[model samples]
Target chain A: MNNSSDPKKYKNSFLNWIEFRLPIVSYIEREYKDYPMPKNCNYFWSFGAMATILLVVLIVTGIFLAMNYTPHTDLAFNSVERIMRDVNYGWLLRYLHSNGAAFFFIVVYIHIMRGMYYGSYKYPRELNWILGVFIFLLMMATAFLGYTLPWGQMSYWGATVITNLFSAIPVIGEGLKTWILGDYTVGNATLNRFFALHYVLPFVIFGVVALHVAAVHVHGSNNPSGIDIKSKNDTVNFFPYMIIKDTLAICVFGFIIAAVVFFGPNLMAEVDNYIPANPMVTPSHIVANWYLAPFYAILRAVPDKLGGVALMFASILILFFLPWLDRVKIRSCNYRPIFKWFMMLFFVNFFVLGYVGMKPAEGIYLLVARMGLIYYFVFLLLITPFIGRIEKTKKLPLSISNILNNNHSEQNKFQKEVN
Target chain B: MRFIFTILFCFTFCFSIFAASETKNAPKHEWSFTGLNGTFDKSAIQRGYKVYREVCAGCHSMNLLYYRDLIDIGFTNDEIKAIASEYTVIDGPNDEGEMFERPAKSFDRFVSPYLNEQEARYSNNGSYPPDLSVITKAKINGPDYIYNLLLGYVDPPEDFELGDGMYYNKWKEGEQIAMAQPLDEGYVDYDDGTENSLEQLAEDVTTFLVWSAEPELEERKSLGIKVLLFFVVAGLFVFIAKNRLWKSVN
Candidate 1:
């Protein structure tokens, strides 16, 4: 069935033979090596590669930890202790897994933020963005389930608080909560089901991630200039150039994670989590891990329980509509002036919400959190849609190559003048 | 609509500020093992073990630790065996199929004070004594909190009211606790000629609890230093390689 116009008519014989049978090797070469990418894509683009590497690190380390972990309530804590003290390199494996989770979230957040800043969610790339949002939601579910496997006080109580939120529903809510727990409380059954789901969800994330990459390849990458590629001069092969840069970024990221794992593994960990789970004794202050803190703040800001749950969920669901929400033709914030300021404000509001979530739900912290919550929704729903139509964007570059090779010095001078 | 929402949000916060008045901030205390290079003081850990045996052991159980684990804290094999034999543990069924009590072996965990949770709560007037195996690592500012709690007890201010079985302490939540003043000056006699005072006992016991909570702390810190060094070197090489690879690009 090989056509006369086929590019691979006289290719490597081994690859041609494989392609004639399965086409798997040809598929990899087409998708990964021959894939044209914007040469102007910055280091921010590297975080996606970093996140994928961390996902693999987490899965490998998680499996080893599961081999040593016991799901029973009575033995779970002791089993973890045994893993720390008795098992060979067990402590190292556990630390790497835990710290790897934290680093994974960090890289994923950067990756998501990069997409937003470059307006990668717009137009033809919308499906890719939607798939990414799904991957993120799955990551959240996996993280929540994995956190409970340790059976620490935070694990137990965090599970209880999150599951009990489902009971805020009128009729099916209570049933759903019980079904989730498999009992009236977060106990041995809850831990078992969570462990089972935690193990399964990562593979599901891996599947969705495959779709995400495929979508990225289908639409091509959005770059800093927000200009489409015109010819071969404006693009680069995905093999040696981008691949080498991605490896360098991953190495540096890995070094930072290793330092944290080895020296102060518990720095980000809550001390209260070291305590064994005691259902009767609730911790005086209950908060989620840092990754979940922003949404946790959103959940707590609303006065009513059901309203809070709805809003907390809506915070994530809102991301799905982002492609339509910001109806601008240009992708990158570098061109959209007013949108750029709001984006920075959005970033600040998120961190502020996180800080407030860590505080007791009272006094000045509560007030600040409430204000931050309002701004978050307003920015996403009202501002993002309308601002694009009114904002006067900068003049577009003809192509990435034009900007890079010709206007490089002139662009720097213009930016300096604008500042 | 957005304006109205912002107004309602602001009004809600005006009321919330009054509700957020009190916060319980745990006080920080200086310890020998606070930083990257910090190591647990061996003698302090041994003294802390003595305090635990004398006072805390009556209520709290360190179920994760075995008698043999004490060897790292300077206890000899014979001493650990002697210590283990002090408690009676239910061993096994004999030829007649009867279970009998026998002295604990060195490998056995510290014998729990009560048989089960129901019994433990009943003896403590409904407030269960938590497991102390990881107590120092489990609580926020656990080392400082434990040390302060030991010395924080005082007569309640005349107007202050306490519930039945509750005692006054400066650092406890609500300024009251179920546990009475546990440590006193010269409570546990130190055979090493160290003076036994409330502060000394508190310090020693805190150190011991930290060790129990993280016995691998010393090894972890040393290994961490080595691993970090290796990463730094390897990272430099990778950086150079990546630079060379990209040299051909515009």
Candidate 2:
């Protein structure tokens, strides 16, 4: 009905005819090419685009891999080896899918951190954050299932250990575990279901990712300064400017992933995964893939099995409450110095917990993990809720354009003084 | 103040806990295929294959590998055919619908020493031999572990006792292994006239095993370099395009 984006505005007859019916041409132009974005968003903002690209890479590679993969526990390991050895460029596809999982998490984690730092989770964008959390959860489930498809010792035992975590429940625990595995133990039924779910969950993640982008587009992008875009002058069209920047970022990310896939393909893979699944011979060390390490640390930190499982679930669920938790007058950590320091400590603690998780849970590692687990909860529950009340805050520029202008003028003044 | 003190306490607690650990670390081996310029030593791999054929093949299986795969490290087609024919593999039979044995082809995978798990376990004193197809990947520090496991056999230290079928190998955790020392000095003669010492045999076999696990290592590395170069060039162009587009705005 709107004449502003009228199909007739375009001289091309075919596009106009198609646009008249579907309006997809105008829809893309408005939503993507002409979408207004804060001009001051930095490289960190590019990670969202990077993550989306990685998701696409994962899906494309995963599909090709599935074509060659056999889901049966007996043949799964051999099939993967066949892919690596015999199938044409199957090695590349397999490496991309596996390493893509890691890279996806890397970019997503950075993107989440970026959001938190700039208060992208605040106010109207809370739904966007919630959708992101959902996507992340789906991704985790998909990755766990994908890992089981290899039918290696780690895959079998990892499934056994994780699914058995359900048995920590009070009454129906054993029933639930059996129900999930489709058998008493992690065997053929478990692998088959996992394979089925693994194939399906990515589409769910894709749907959630679509909702996430839509929600982000509705709210517009949060910039580095966390100042709202006050005028058209404060923003740029998303087409050339943001697209090019995202392209550059994606290229750099692709380079890193390519290096890992080709040169150091096994850099992130556990060596034990190369062996076929032997239910009789339990590996001395059964560690989850690296991305799940921090939560795995939390799970292991508690002595009781149920308590550990509860805490691990709660750890992720707590993120849903983050928007309300760190309630402050100011949005960005750029203005909240104390909160910024705490955030840095929180990130460092996460990394430490991840490291400790990978190490065999013995004396020192356990102690460190326990301490880190405590700090993680403390930061989420206690510190975040209280820090805003006591923290000293810096003055923020009134708008996005004002901040950039101020910085530019200041730089000019410094240059002039030097001259 | 309480937070700082808690952190300090945790640090000390961790330090004290770790200090008590005394797990012996595996000694690193300086191997040919280690760094960026690394490539498999072809002669060593050939010798290692001989070692595998002569000694290790009796127990350990390499079911993933075909006789033709040896051509990558340099084996003549005739040699491969001869190797394949030496082992008779069980196959299905003619119009009678029964099973029979026949000589293998170049593409047939290595035959297992035992027909199945029960047979394997029974023959090896109830301990099944692990497959060597991806042994160099299945274990941690795989090449090093294999090398050390081969040469690690020694007289049991004072106060240490071994059970039947177990040999003392310092390289393995618990300092014991099931398989007795299979190699001695001048164990298998190398056609290339290399020394057949235990260490030499171990090193050569480890190299071969690494290749067996990952035959495309060379292709992967070379392709990685080219892809990286492509990305760099593309990235530079994107960077320029981005800067140029943003020049007027920023």
TM-score of each: 0.89, 0.94
Model 1 per-residue lDDT tens digits across residues B136-179: 76665678888888889989999999999999998887999999
Tell me the DockQ of each model, to 2 decimals.
Answer: 0.35, 0.46
lDDT of each candidate versus the true structure = 0.85, 0.86
Per-residue error at B172 for model 2, in Å?
1.3
What would the per-residue lDDT of candidate 1 be over residues A223-296, giving only the tens digit for each residue?
A: 98877889888888898678877876766666677767877677667777888888877988888877787889
True contacts kept of each: 0.62, 0.78
Summarize candidate 2's per-residue lDDT along A1-419 as a digit string, tens digits.
67556548578988887888898888899989999989988878888888888899899999999999999988999999999988988888899999899888877887888888888998878899999988988888898999899999899999998999999999999999999999999999999999999998998999899999988999799988887889999999999888998898788778867867887677678777998999989988889787888889999999999999999999999999898997785778899889898887898798788778878889999999999999999999999999877888999888888888998999999999999
In the predicted model 1, the residue pairs found to clash are: A362-B20, A363-B20
RMSD of model 1, in Å?
6.1
User: How accurate locally is residue B146 in candidate 1, as Cα lDDT from 0 to 100?
Assistant: 88
Candidate 1, which CAPRI tier?
acceptable
